[model samples]
Target: MEEIWFAINDIPMDVLSRLPVKTLLGLKCVSKDWHRLISERSFIRHQLKRAEPVSGFFFQERFQWCDDDIKAISYIPVKMEGSEVQHSVFNFLPESVVLSAVSNGLICCRSCFPSPQPVIYVCNPLNKEWVTFPWSTPDKRSSLGLAFDPFKDPIDKSTDFKVVTIHQTASDMEVEDEDKDSYLTFDIYSSKTRTWHRSREMCHCHHSLFKNKGIFVGGALYWLTDGDQILMFDVQNELSWLVTVPIPLVQFDSIPEMCIGESEGKLHYVLISEGGLHVWVLEDYLDFTWELKYSISLDEMEKENTEFLCNIQQRVESRMAVDTTPWMDPLAFKDSLLFMRVAARIYLFNFETRKLEELCTLSMLGPNSIISPIVLPYSMSLIPLG
Candidate 1:
């Protein structure tokens, strides 16, 4: 029987990698040899490279507290069930763990309570597997980012990942005049080496960490700065540098929100304004040149005659001149679907047709249970942990 299963599992590596991650996970119980083979790092990498489209969106639905918003802050996955129905998976993630970013199929999460600084973890929700970073003193002072290669090996369950931490002076630490602005260091953790190393003092140490999450595209981690500059960390070479993001057309007051992202296997920037959401691709990384690719008109979205968010114009009008404040941070962009959040409501916008439709309403989760939900891009992969 074991020999029969072995014969069934033995196949061309590339051919096996082409199979869906769910199919591969199902094959693991067929035999011990199959389990070992399916768990190979190279195999996982290959599978991720050929993995299918994103399976769902992972967002946190927070519940209000009696005092100062206890914020039952939770990580939840609202998975797509066919075209219209969505199912949520909660309690699978660690409690009070704030997920900051997702790369490939793994999400980067940090501890939110009990400690002044958070402990970081890289997790795979599909398999309920996670790996925690070794606690270090510097982790208390820095913001962390996760970067991985999802395209080359999205299928394999064992692709190595890197975590980059930017440490500034600890808020609680008493600082002398000399120590002020003297504490810029980056702590990098390599899964391959299973170790952490610190870099020399970075130039821009005093600037506070950006409130927005970091995006990893083309093997580099990107973070926005208050001074309109971007911090780029090369994951492959483990080097840090600053780059000026291409300036967008001034469309509104308060400087319309924008962020860097990855689309179609290339690095791109997304600008959200009253005019529309403009996409600019970084054509030349060497010269820092950009090319405007697509400009989506928000006005067209208001014209769609759909039941979902049909009265968005009315909702926007009630907020005086400020209008509505979207949750910011798009979940994922693919095949014309732009997933984003407006407060507690998640919507799917089609850039081609300019049709905006609500995907899911957190009010269904319970009244006021959806405090400060964050939209995160989710790609299901066959990731396994030992």
Candidate 2:
């Protein structure tokens, strides 16, 4: 290995950055010099730029019928055409933990319900390095968000990463009635300081924020509410506010199925309605201007993959109530690729080619359970949290 490193020591960084993350990781062990070069923040960023838009995804199936909320997390590689879901990839974490939020290549996993004290673990599955955050008291009805920017100044001693927890205020939680008024509040945990600070800001909304993972875009974290608004929290300023969703409540007779994502540092919203999947991008963040980028016809997709979808539908119907589940659910969007679920199978939709290809099938659920897999778009990175 020493001789090999000496022979290739003069290789340009541009060429080395183009190498796969796994290859770069192996090269780090060649010599201390190679390790230092690979560990530089600039090299990490350049390598990420050369990496695929999205290398793969991590998804966790939430059993709607189970109260424990303990589920197995699986990974599906995008380049692997016939890859089986890797179930043991996250075996380093506790089995009772469920995926809550993911940013960059780091994922946040929270302990299951019915615990005296709840805990959250933020880690990079690629390196298997993690940090734990245990609460002294139980936090009821909260949504966790992770905010990490690789471009942040390395010299800044304030924060390397942050975890924002949004929840109902103590007084608001005391109110048992769902129709009563309540206040939304949040607390942020800083990785650099290894401490949490509560925010003074609060807002009133019709219902609680969806427990789904928060979406990180730009420098803020966003969580969708039960109503047609999203709660946005600024990481640096430590302020929170609400932004109206693109699809107003007045426009739709009933709520439409939609999900939020980020691509190229801009927010993108995907909604499924009218026998098609509509994509809207926030072109102007300040003015809140949205532009319709793509409208894909699900009918055409169904026609092309009739046999495959039929087989998936048969398996889905045997386990879940077909009427309750959305026919086509958008899972994650990144770059030009959109990961969605038609029946129990996940597919990759490329905007450049306007084609959809099957990626993997979700795991089977118990006879009494319904599966609703939460998929997070992931790109491999070797950045360390500590």
Candidate 3:
């Protein structure tokens, strides 16, 4: 028995790191040395680098009254095959907390009840470990963004994370249009020192920032704003800038549907207008240059998926059984595939083949239930949050 254990430990780390987290967890019982090797931060990093990160979607349902509010969150695996390992990833969190931001498998959640000072939590659902801290803010409606990178700082023994909050000091009625962009205050929290730093530096956002959670990509946090603009904050340099949206292809009087997402380690902007659907990629990050990647008209889409459309119409009519208005929303992007919502069904549009396939159908809650606009991207990891 002793000789067999020694032979197993002799396996090269490069080969051992390729094993799945579940297999590695079982291997830890082989010996103390094996447990130590699996628990080491360097070994964990190597395993993450060699493995494919499992991605999924988080759907949040909220109902609000004057003071009483109710919220529920559900996890949906994006893979076509029903090979999901975990069904309830966020059941570990206590009640009354809503997910704020998701980055690299770590989620930032805050208290949903109205409060001047709210308790913020950073958690890893994979291992069921979490850390909490209180944030002092007068505004209950302020926006919070989480930035976490596993390989951000090489010197640090563990992964370091940061949380940023943006809020305006004055009410919208008191602030004029010219001064609206100047009154925003930024509160930054660092995990290394476990402290919050306030910055009053001006970030020129002519429009109000969207209520949706910010997207983190390439060392920066991005938030969409009204009037076709994006607000960006650099976590490393502590600077803020604006990125302009590309002009719409069609001259539509109403506002078009727009969303920002991350794919292949780059930022992408998607727009759905009366003319059709257009996708853009940030080709040059420094110069803020955008290159249109895919453009498909509604006519072309209807022509391509006529049979699928007929089937979806029949499903919705039979299952929904309500006079609800249909909607199409872009949820997230990954590896050149677009995840979108049509009515109550989720779909994946392949950019290479120009084909669309149904992923899953969301359960209809009730006649009055409406799907929330926020669909967060999730990646599974075994990284600990301290």
Candidate 4:
């Protein structure tokens, strides 16, 4: 009976669809014929459709300089049964390298430089495969953001990813201007084409917030703009569109800057307040209706230093000090784990249990380190590909 099943060239589509992704992947090694059948794009897409999503944490190690010599350390989270495991350390990158983003198991790093023109490298730290993405123009100043399409169609599987760069262009005036109109030019680097294409469309705002605002949702990148609108850049279509967000009838000072994140397969925006944080869910992206859901008060932070928590610079610098720091950021995750970044520590707020636990503290070198740490929407704990 088993031989009869193996003898068939065309297996039932329904059976193939129902097989677990891991089982389907394992069957590829049974034989050459089986390998070819299981490796088909159609089969892979079906498997992805039924596959479950897992979360992983993305961690970075900081090094201190002693006698003009830099020494580094690594850290990892140990998931034990009950006790909070101390995170393990790993290998360190070059002295001047800074992590920009992590997507689909790839860690994107850029060589830190005084100027924006720098070398960008992406690597699968687990697999040890690294790829270098060169800049389009050597002298141009640009800021890069990396992302991958989770819902990408398997039929068009390509390892090539997307990099959005905001470049500084030559203006009509003599001196540089901070105004939005003077600062123009946006370019996209496609790994598949191995080239850069200039985008003529103007960005809706001058705020640098959108540089890291691109959040992955349904295989597309979503961002919030300074023009009081939500923008999405479709990877498949290579086009951008704006989505309206319902703004409350509050005073200008009452409206705080909004941040984008994902939760439970839906897109969410977090409104940071002096007193606490309020989370709003977008039921329909097209309709632009926002419903208030969870509201966390500052009084529940467990810490008394309200002034220090509000200072962004001080909060970042503190997180850079030690390996086991407590901090929190409004990051998107499948589970209701509110990862908050306090001074130098990260705390996990479990919505289901209504509890807050110290996750880990980030370690930094001497107080003179020049790099500013960046937080992406996704975490390494939520995505194990790192």
Off by over 4 Å in 2: 1-11, 26-36, 39-42, 49-52, 155-159, 169-179, 249-255, 300-323, 364-371
Q: Model 3, residue 127: what's the lDDT?
A: 77
lDDT of 3 by residue, 8-78 (tens): 66455777789877678788898898888887777788887754444667666554334533356666666
Per-residue CA lDDT of model 4 for 1-386, tens digit only, reads 67686566556545765675446557667778767756555554555455343233443333333212122322223232353422222243433455555554456666654435566676655434567767676432345556665455233454557776655444554655665354434577777777878776554444333423456666556665555667765555566656665664143333244456667656777654443566777787667778877776655543544433465433333443224332344443334555454556555556556566555554432242222223443333111122
Residue 23 in model 3: lDDT = 78
Tens-digit lDDT track of model 2 for 1-386: 76575457545577788987878889999888779878776677677666445778787766565566645667878876666668777887764677778888888877777765679888888888788887533464577889887766442232278888877754554577866677777788887778887888777766557534588888888776667777778888887777777767445433346677887787787776543567788776556678888876656655665655553333322333324665566677777678877766678878767777887655432232124556778887777755
Question: What is candidate 1's lDDT per residue for 1-386, written digit by digit as tens?
Answer: 75465366545566778887778889889778768877787777667667366555655543344322232433323343445433334345555566667787788877764556556778887788888776465343356788877554343445578888776654445665545654446777877778888765364444454534567877887765544556777767766666666773333443355655666767666666655577777776667788887785554554563555344433433433323344343445543456665667766666667766666666644465334344566767766654
Highest lDDT model number: 2
**Candidate 4 segments whose C-alpha is farther than 4 A from its true place:** 1-55, 59-96, 114-117, 138-141, 155-157, 168-184, 210-213, 223-231, 236-258, 284-287, 299-335, 362-372, 377-386
Window of ten residues with lowest summed lDDT in model 2: 313-322
Would you list the rank order by TM-score, best first?
A: 2, 3, 1, 4
Q: How do the predictions measure up, each by TM-score?
A: 0.74, 0.83, 0.82, 0.62
Clashing pairs in 1: 44-156, 45-153, 47-154, 47-155, 48-153, 48-154, 48-155, 49-151, 49-154
